[model samples]
Target: MSIRLDLARDSGLTLSDALSVLLPTPAQDLSDLPRTTELVQPFKPFHDHFAAQGFSSVDASDAPCGDVILFVPRAKAQARALVHHACQRASGKIVVDGVKTDGIDSLLKEVRKRVPVEGPISKAHGKIFWFAADADAFSDWALSDMTLAGGYRTVPGVFSSDGIDPASELLIAAMPDRPGARIADLGAGWGYLSSRLLEREGVHSIDLVEADHVALDCARHNISDPRARFHWADALNWAAPEPLDTVVMNPPFHTSRAADPALGRGFIAAAARSLAPSGQLWMVANRHLPYEAALEAHFTRFEELGGDARFKIFNATRPRRRAGAS
Candidate 1:
């Protein structure tokens, strides 16, 4: 295996960003290789980018013995476990790749503490590090002993896994009482809100739209309603096939490499577009976000239902239409 680091001149931007432009095609080939079983986590876009190339992917599952795993660790603990798993089962060399902005360099240093690396270290926006390992050494680093907390067990790289997100909690509290409505949860990370909505007696159909394949995988397992549908979409570009009665979202606020407040702004615009003329939009967001102005601009009636110092929930409804007109 080979390792390379792509260093970025801009301290604010990750080398991964540079590499994205420099090596899009070749990187595609590398990520597309067929594997028996692959584990991708902690990052959604990378996993989906790889999955698009046709690899059998698993999100945050234990690496099957003899299976070739594509691992992306969101935390130190998960990185260690995947390294351990790879060493034990890998018939080929161990391959570990990460973006410098994501702290792949630090992770590599940690991995080196356990097993020595034995290949060319390559650098770009970050680095790709690989080494050989024996099954015993790998198994020693494995962590099956870790337990769940608050009924949610997360290995690593999941969105806000330590506990329930306050924003989601707020959104759930403010969810419409109307039953049998078609609902879509945009950026439904782990399906926390979506799953709760599914349990609602009033929900008729639910679509969980997550851009990251890894998050969607977790969502599928987390939400099992037959009415649940999953869409891997760039939420910025996704359009609903049909107008929806209710659109519930805790839209993501950031896009990689920049603080694109407009990311969520676009989601808001799309939600407004997707809703029926009389449908409602319930969304939760950080308190400081300048969304009230946007909400007012899009909807005929809007209200701030609940909030505290850190977060706020907005309820916006489209204008009721008058009798038959052009």
Candidate 2:
């Protein structure tokens, strides 16, 4: 929570055509983080926020920037990758800022080992540090595909990048072993369910729709099958190519630091809209969230299939069909 305005006041670094990585929306009544011509954020919902805020975004690897301001993410691999890439590509000082909760101190220490570290203004439960771009150092951190548990191809910072999410596993276990239906895995991360769906006896086809391009890229690698279609679009906005026979997912529950039930609710509505009359949905959510209202509104039938202490799976059938239908 280091006040970005302080970074401008304290740091001697010049900012022009700057690049912002995993940058958040500037707080209201605030001024003075470097102006970024390009933003590198993989999360789809945040992309909407950045665009609305008038920040031009470009891909992290290819963006040509004079300076960089990195809002360090929680994942060590992702943070390190951004730091290394920015350090290599930017022409000016690279400023790193993040809360201690987000591993700012560790990043500062590791960064000090790699380059000349400078004024780290500590404020608002976070640290803001800077260093001159050393294109030669941190060669080890260049982006490379890494393997996670269960042989899943994951880039750093993708949801559950370190391992298979237990909630997803529960959904997988409860999934129909013989889903003869054409399916859609909304918010499919790394194609875990899509790959598993292919393992079933009668799964006709699976459309893996995920918003994060990095995660979708890993999905492509994980489930490289002609039967598996891919869509890199927001789950809430993407409609199935055709009405689906079945939908299975663990809809994402949050976009930022705050819990967003609206995100999951939007997924439910999308599922209902894209399902055929006889189609069914198998979804998992946290036990306490209030998705029942949405499910009831969109589907003619809804039932809780099973649950554990942390997660619950549901089965909803016979989509209610929006106003005009065949």
Candidate 3:
């Protein structure tokens, strides 16, 4: 991103003095951008990361701006939707930057078809380009909330946006008939498990804790039961409002394309901290990832429930107290 910006500046690209908004940027140095720059990051972890650095950050933005810099997400439909939204919100240039793995070449080709594009400066296996904002040219690209087969509401770019995740399905089927009265679904994506858990008897409240703001918004639309509560937060740091009787999850293992088991491990630790002393944890995971050690560290006892070849289920009880923990 810095390379492109430098090249653009060398070639006489001058940004306006008004607000410049950057959407969906990861944790990085932003000293080069104008002080007026605001960040729009829907993912809670990244949003909090920037917020800690004293940058103006928000989960979403609707205000008009002098310019908009978009960091393309992996989802193609989501990338297009962001472009359309950027055009709608920007009064000046619209900068698009993305890595090759994220389909920057394809996005550039598609954008060129709609408007005149300039300076596709390439460096470090990625490309960056800019174009004048023309909202009319990309009107059809605006995306609305999608309705899945079970009447679930979702939007582009969220995890498992297309339909219910198979791993989550496995966990749901493996869950005990009456798991607990007070429960939390850590890393809950769009509340699919929470919705199904609501069907079970003796469920007093189900907290849907998710990091993605967009997914949590969909969860709100899909769930209307009074017992369902939604929280847009990083599950690694989030604590249940009350000591949970049970925690259910198909914890996310990836922050990017590569699988990271540490994310799931963090979820297990967080769940243990949120549960009561005698509380239980019910979780599903991919077959190959190792989480037994983490489970053992956090809980007194754990055993495999049941799962097919692709996924495994575990039920753990008796969260262990830390040495110095009160």
Best by TM-score: 3
The true-versus-predicted C-alpha distance at residue 188 of model 1, in Å, is 1.1
Q: Which candidate, 1 or 2, would have the higher lDDT against the true structure?
A: 2
Worst 10 residues of 2 by lDDT: 26-35
Positional deviation of residue 250's Cα in model 1 after best superposition, in angstroms: 1.0
State candidate 3's TM-score: 0.96
Every candidate's lDDT = 0.62, 0.79, 0.87
Per-model tally of clashing residue pairs? 18, 0, 0
Model 2: lDDT equals 0.79
Clashes of 1: 18
lDDT of 2 by residue, 8-98 (tens): 5455655574555545544322223343456676666666666666666543456566877788888889889888888778888888878
Give the poorly placed runs of model 3, Cα more than 4 Å off: 324-326
lDDT of 3 at 319: 91
User: Cα lDDT of model 3 overall?
Assistant: 0.87
Q: What CA root-mean-square deviation does each model show from the true structure?
A: 7.3, 3.1, 1.6
What TM-score does candidate 2 get on C-alpha atoms?
Answer: 0.88
